[model samples]
Every structure is written in C-alpha cells, then in structure tokens.
Target: MKKQRVVAFVPIKLNSQRLPMKNILPLGEYSLSWYIFDSLLKVKDIDDVYVFCSDEEIKKHIPSQVKFLKRDRYLDGDLVKGQEIYQSFIESVDSDIYILSHTTSPFLAANTIEKALSKMLLEDYDSALSVQKKQTFAWFEEKPLNYELNNIPRTQDITPVFIETSGFFMFRKNIFEGYRRRIGFKPFLQEVDDVEAIDIDTKEDYEFAIQVYEQVKQRAYINN
Candidate 1:
C-alpha cells in the first residue's frame, strides 16, 4: 500500500471582535499563534504545516517550517461560517488526511497529535478529534442533562461526558469531501487533559492561558 499524504492547517485572521489582535498578542517569548505552529511542525506524521490566512504579514511571525496559504478576504468576515473557510482551504490543499487546528489551542502538544494519527491508522478510524472528559453534573435548558434530579449520584459514579475541544480535528480527505464535515461516520474520541484543551476565545480565556503557560514553563524549568 502506498503511503498517504498527511497535512495540517490552522486558519488565522488579523482582526478579532472579542479579543483585538489576539493571534499576534504577546505570549511568553513569541506571539500567541507561535505555540500551535510549533506543535504542528513537531508532528512526525504530518507532511506539511500551513497557516491559512488572508493577511501577508503573518508570515513574519510563523516559523519557517510552516508554510503560508493565502486565503480570500471575504472568508475572514465575522458573519462567515467556519465551514466555508474549511471548505475553501480543503479545496486548495490536496492531502489524504487533513488536521484542522486553531492557534487558540496553544498548549496542544505534538505527542497528542501523533497519538490521534496513530489511532486512526492502526484502528481503522475514519476521523479523530481531541476532546475533554468531564464527570461533573451538567445541565442544559434548565434541565439536568447528565444526571437525574431524583437520584443524584456521586460525580465519580456519573458517566463521563466528552466535550469536543477546538484543539484539533483529524479526518480523512474523503470524509470532508463526501459529508462536508470534519467528523466521519466512525470517529475516535481522543480525550485530553483540561490544560491541553484550553481554547482562547475571550479576554478571560486569554488571561487564563497566559497563567497556564507560565506555570507550564516553571514546571519545565524545575524538571530540567
């Protein structure tokens, strides 16, 4: 059997409504987007890493290992759906397997990405997604979603809920082309720790990520 081509892409935009210039904002020694780009480059199975953005200035901050794919400005609109951006990029890039990731998920490690790929390759899974497992009581629409009101069970006894994290989505090219979705019929839910699943969306999220990053750095220093 021929070896399949695997590629990863992260969509980026210069402007943000919630957090202004969040991608370019300072985080540790590099910009906020630097960590994810670095993580993707370290993935052994990924053939190439791309930063899909409409702006040309992003090229300066991104690592040389990552390529820049210029996208249409219209796709950067706040009203534009993520699917539209995803579809446009998938059409432009040809690969057997695609890893769709985001810059906000800076703490997502390279080993986790390799594990997701290994699960798909070894287990014959059609798709793989990074998720966060939670065992706490969850409620939705003013009703108990995970637990019953009549019989309240301990958190440990309750079934664990897996939340689809924005860290990464790995899928076969055929899945996207056929279903027009990132997930396939058979998806391997790769559960990650809370720290790894941190996605920076708002101001609070960004601040929390910075603290997490500092603590992570301190731990690494102590270990070294």
Candidate 2:
C-alpha cells in the first residue's frame, strides 16, 4: 500500500477588518505568521507546509521550506468568506490529507498538532476538528443554556459544551470531494487546551492573545 501524504495549509490575508494588518503584528522577535510557520514545520509526520496570502509583507516571515501561494486582490476583503476560499484551495492543491491552520493562532502548539495528526491517521478518521470543551454559564434570550435557575447546581456538574476551535483542522482531501466541506460525515472532535483555542479576530482578542502567549511560554519553560 502506498503511504499517505500530509500537508498543512496556513492562510492569512492582508486586510483584517477588526484589527487592520493584524497578521503582521509582532510577537516577540517574530511576527504571528513566523510562529505558526515554524510550528507547522516541527510536525514530523507532515510532508510539507504551505502559506497562502495576498500581502507581499508576509513573504518575509515565510521560510524557504514552506511553499507560498498567492491570493488575488479581489478576495482580500472582509466580504469574502473562509469556506469559499478553502473550497477554492481544495480544488487547486493535491494531497492525501490537509492540516488547516491560521496565522492568528500564533501560540498554536506543535504537540497539540502532532497528537491530532497521529489520532487522525491511526484511527482512520475521515476528518478532525479541534474543540475546546468548556463548562460555563450561558443564556439564550431569557432561558439558561446549560442549567436551570431552580436547580442552582455547581458549574462542574453541568454538562460541558464543545466549541469548535478554528485554530486548526485535519481532514482527508476527499472530504472536500465527498461533502464539499472541510469535515466529513464521521468527523472527530479533537479537544485542545483552552488557551490554544484563541484565534485573533478583533483588536481586543489580539491583545488578550499576547498576554496569554506569554503565560503559555512561561508555563512551558517551568514545566521543562
């Protein structure tokens, strides 16, 4: 049997409506794209990594090992949706599997990615999405989302909610061919750390992520 090939898709755009030029934001010595690019390269199972974006500034952050793909100016606006672009990407790239990641995820850990990849290939899963399983108080309109007002139960007792972390995805290339989506019918929900769930969409989110990234780095250093 032929061995399956795996590649990572890291996409960033020049325009960020909430935080303009957010992708170019500096994180310590490197930019946000540099962090994710280096992390993807750390995954031993991945055959190659690709960076797709519209801005030429991003080229400076990319290493020679990562293949860079250009996006036209027309799709660089806030009006463009991610699903449409990814579907378009699927049409162009050929590989056995794709690991999707975002430049906003500067603190995305290589260990988390390696585990997701290993699980996907070992268990024969068709697709995988990272999730942050959280237990918290929430409401929709006047009704409580996860608990009853009368019960007044502890937060720990409440059933957890699984939130899809757009941080990353692992899927067979065929998933696009079969379902026209990144995930297949039998998709696996891979749980990731709460901090790892952060993806910068707004200015506030970007600022918060920097503090969290520092804490994460400190924790890793102490543990090591």
Q: List the residue pairs that clash in candidate 2.
A: none
* Candidate with best TM-score: 1
Off by over 4 Å in 1: none
lDDT of 2: 0.82
Give per-residue lDDT, candidate 2, residue 173.
82
lDDT of 1 by residue, 1-224 (tens): 77889999999998888999989888899998898989989988889999999998888777988999999999889999988998999999999999999999999999999999988877789999999998989988999888889999998899778899999999999999898989999999988998999999899999998899899999999999
Q: For model 2, where is the 10-residue window of minimal lDDT?
A: 83-92
